[model samples]
Target: MRVRELLNYFKPYGFETPDWMIVEEYGLRPDQIIRMDLNTSPYLPQKWLNSLGSRISKLRFNRYPDTTYRELVGEISRYTNVKPEKIIPTNGADEAIDVIVKALIDCGNEAIISSPTYDYFRVSVELQGGRVVSIPRKKNFADNVEGILSSINDKTRLIFLCSPNNPTGNTTSYDDVLNILDKASDVAVVVDEAYYEYCGETFIELTETYDNLIIVRTLSKAFGLAGARVGYIVASKGTIKMLNKTRPPNSLSLASIELAKIALRDYETVSRNVRKIVKERERVKELLSTLPRIYAYPSKANFILFELLEGDAKTLHKKLMEKGIVIRHIELNWVQRYLRVTISLPEHNDRFLKILEKILKEKT
Candidate 1:
């Protein structure tokens, strides 16, 4: 028998796994390809880039990183306005999801998820041999708060929600999350604010009032540090203490921790970039609306989700790929015919719109 029979494994989460070789695959130079699939910042702040040299010395790579991650926690505390003891530094938001699952989920138990928000939350719960009770969102990808509450039962151990959800580019109402928090007693509720900087609203303030609330965030989006892989969890001190045990020692590299600290030092730069991205996102939505048979949905994050009202999204995705432009083609039942594109630099955005117009014109 195969070893697969003795153990369980599933394929990893599927986002546009960036292939650098896409440059040669499409017969384009490195600079010609526009990576709009991942909602990462198109421009890395020069201030942060310049500080990487001096900051490199701060990490003691010769030795293992501090298990407690004291310095990183201190920096994060100042940045996020959360106390040091209440924070747990993670390798990425992905790690925080897994750690929370491991901490709360027992084998054969259940976790509640608002569907199509973030896939990894489902993956994390399933990997622990727990059942995922997926409550589908309504049209335009809005959450059904009552459905979520009714789904929670005695076996329910965790509930996960993502604000400014991935792939769909919409923020769940904060009041709905508060409603869940008030109702779901004895169950851990995780509100992932990974795109918090883009939207500028948070449930972090409620962490003090609710003991079971967990807020996870990452530096990958607006901070322009996706490559560094740094994220953190903000919860009450006791909850943080429990998660600390589940986390492996020195899980975050010294370089990553130091680089994150440097990146956080300049909020003004981050804010300026966020403003530009929001502006460009609106411009893209406006342009998409002007196109024949396309509907651009309102977005709070740095990406815009639009539907091809008449054509196949997969076909359009391939056409854009031919032009060396990459974006997310979401094929979920709720978002059928939908596509999501990151708000990129001005020239990249212009190029995408120009080619898209040509493709639709050809189809007509």
Candidate 2:
């Protein structure tokens, strides 16, 4: 089968191919599975489910969604304290990334990204024919702000920053983000806050001060609406208007729009779940630290990243799966020693730790 050459760029993601097979071989039905690999919310609000059921039965399926999704935009506006005209919702935050890259990036132009961050930023930029200039983070998993500043040049068109960065579980400093914006005045800066609810630190306020700043958020993470695939970008009204030109009309489904509205309405439930996850995250860290060979990093997100001091992470991951416990194993050369596990329900968390302890004791 002939495929687009761009597919070659994704070869480094070794998990993409074998991940499904692992699930199948282990009889890991989604419902039966203890899924700590994806960092998904364990609880979906009852309100969203009830609303979706009623909307499906009452809404017109034959007709297309509102071309602009203006009402949904208004809800997001009120939620974020940004004007409706300044927000644009896409199929998901992933699509929002594609839209921004297409709108602002040109062939041979460059986008700056901090290394060992989310892999999608590099994928999207390369797919759009832009050069990816990586600035490696400090050993402590913080952005190398000085290195990023030095990398910007005339061809630099965009910069992607992932806060509480995926897998790493740490946040970028607000002052550092402001400094980058101050120096890279000519480039567009995208702050991806997919885990915003967990950290509660954001640069959405900076949109008022800098026209080049853009913030991307998704309902998939903290809101437990990943299946709805709703995500949005916040920017100045002018930038949003430009993004709309590239966005396909009626890109979101009627059901997704309705569910997002319902999710927003029940913000209290979401907040409660966030508190549970935060509390459980700290407990998970404490337990993992006491295990014989694990060194867990401090986190602001719903997941923890750790390293095995005496054994290979890949081996540990395989051993866990044999017992039906699943977590992410970081096998890339840069982060090869690390394994990331989501902060799941208390019982699930306890089960994982118990199994991990057994494995370490056997090795010793």
Candidate 3:
């Protein structure tokens, strides 16, 4: 295929309508639209924002950030309880994925993915000219450990797993992860814990035991830093060294680094917001289950995956969009009826539920 044709095959992240388009077409102001598609925190880290605002005046925009990122690494070390040498920060978990794939995946190598999870991992691997073998998850959205292991071969170089997984909001079993690690000892197994703050389960501890294990996490979700784009990788020091060679120098801006440090300093606030979001998640999930013909999957993370039993997901998504409420419509072969919604503030959640119920009732 030509370069343009190959580019057409590339799948980028998320579906979005520009703010200006929404305003012009939907006749809704940007603030009126409730964004439930992107799994971002509705609540801001007010204290961190306040601190960041005060510190922004002190930042030197003209000078570049320290490429070594020692100070930021120290903060992350304290936060993650991992040594600084074992951590390499990236622009976001997305960049961490790209950098790791770039470092470890060469042309013609294969990477195995647990399907119906995040799409970016496959994109990263393919960009490196690596082939992707996707093993579908079980009916319950759990990893198919046997299928994944059987597919591993001399060409397999990486395996990607997401915990409290995107869209599904379910976690991979710890034993399943351990089994994959033991069997595929030569290939790198990257576990993405981007929603860790919501679930509070981690495989970071296993990194000490397994050299091939890599953990990528982001502050974009729970830390309320999506726009700032801060994330990091946790692996053995040797693995970190190899990834560092491919990681771009000064990928994170000075403002982002400083804001992340401030956010880390006030970890208590992040935890408090997490608790609120988790509580709201349960409340929202319960309410969603009460809706007729809708099944809301049990979620450990801050978002919930909902399956519509009767209606078309695309039609429902369009209806929600017309009403200025946006949630993701799952497009996988096995889950065409599924839609994922991020847990927002209580009022916003109530609004979404009300609007959604009305839409379903109207269809009936």
Candidate 4:
């Protein structure tokens, strides 16, 4: 016999994971490639490389991880300057989103999201039998404060906002976020700051004032631990105390917790790399500005979004792959001509720049 029917609003979504399968089909070796997609950090902090594995091994792997995650919570609290009671370490930021949506929104309730933002928020909200209200961003991919404020209603249980928003690579203003929070204090507002290390601006401080405010963060990007998948949520202790029940037992692995703690301890290493990536971002944007028919948007994240105003983004993306370099080509209707690339090391960044120049010159 078959299982029960699925929820109709549960739409299939595409995640930009590694492309090793495609690389092998094309008869290419892994070492001959540079991946400028997915926005993973190219640098690994030295202390993380040095000690986490051994520290993790000291504990018994046969035992389940600490569901409470006392040590990890302490580290995250120290790192974020939030209290330990306000935190819940998750498997990843994705899990944090899923749990929050499941906890707050009921079937037929609605969650508001600014469009062209992260897809998983929509996926999570819908999967939990909730409707997603889409408010389009401003022309520059900036958050639209008015649109979100007007969209909220009695059924609106959650609002997902991304800073240095994915794909678009720009942040929503703090004042705009404050405005939304000030008016919609009754609804849960999640400001996902996965790229906070690069931008250095966060809503963590505001969580103290607004119990409905939840902040989601990850060790994936700036910490170079995408593979580890460590993430967490911070809010007022009472709010966190309520949502913590929605999370599954042993949500994060032992290694992930230890490693996240290790990474937070070595703030210098990650901070240094973030500084480099920010510099590379500026450099890449300035260089792209000089090229004809291309527009580079200002960003505070680890990646840059550029537009091929005169050609197909997919074609250019495919051409870049032939050179063993990979960048993302976004397919959203609002940004059909845009492509995205992670800021890598200076050498890899140089190669991407030079090859891109060659491709554009040929088009010219």
lDDT of each: 0.86, 0.88, 0.91, 0.87
**Runs of candidate 4 exceeding 4 Å displacement:** 1-9
Q: For candidate 1, which ten residues in a row score worst on lDDT?
A: 3-12
Worst 10 residues of 4 by lDDT: 2-11
By lDDT, the candidates rank as: 3, 2, 4, 1
Which RMSD does model 1 reach against the true structure?
A: 1.8
Regions more than 4 Å wrong, model 1: 1-11
lDDT string for model 2 (1-364, tens) is: 9987767755433343244676688767555557788888988877678768977888887999888788898889888999888899999998999999999999899999988888888888887888899988888989999999999989999999999898799999999999999999888999999999999999998998888999999999999988889999999888888888888778799989999998887788999999999999999999889988789999999999998877677888888887778898885336577899998889999999998899889883
Query: Best candidate per TM-score, number?
Result: 3
lDDT of 1 at 338: 82
Give the range of the ten consecutive residues with the poorest summed lDDT in model 3.
Answer: 1-10
Per residue, candidate 1 scores C-alpha lDDT tens digits across 1-364 of 5554214556557766455677667777776778899889987877676787777876578999888889889989999988899999899999999889999998889998878777898778877878889898887688889999999888999988888888677888878988998899689999999989988989998888888999999999999999889999999888998888898778888888888888787787889999999999989999989998888989888999888998788989988987889998886765469888999999999999999999999882
Off by over 4 Å in 2: 1-20, 27-32
> Top lDDT: which candidate number?
3
lDDT of 3 at 182: 96
State residue 47's C-alpha deviation in candidate 4, in Å. 3.9
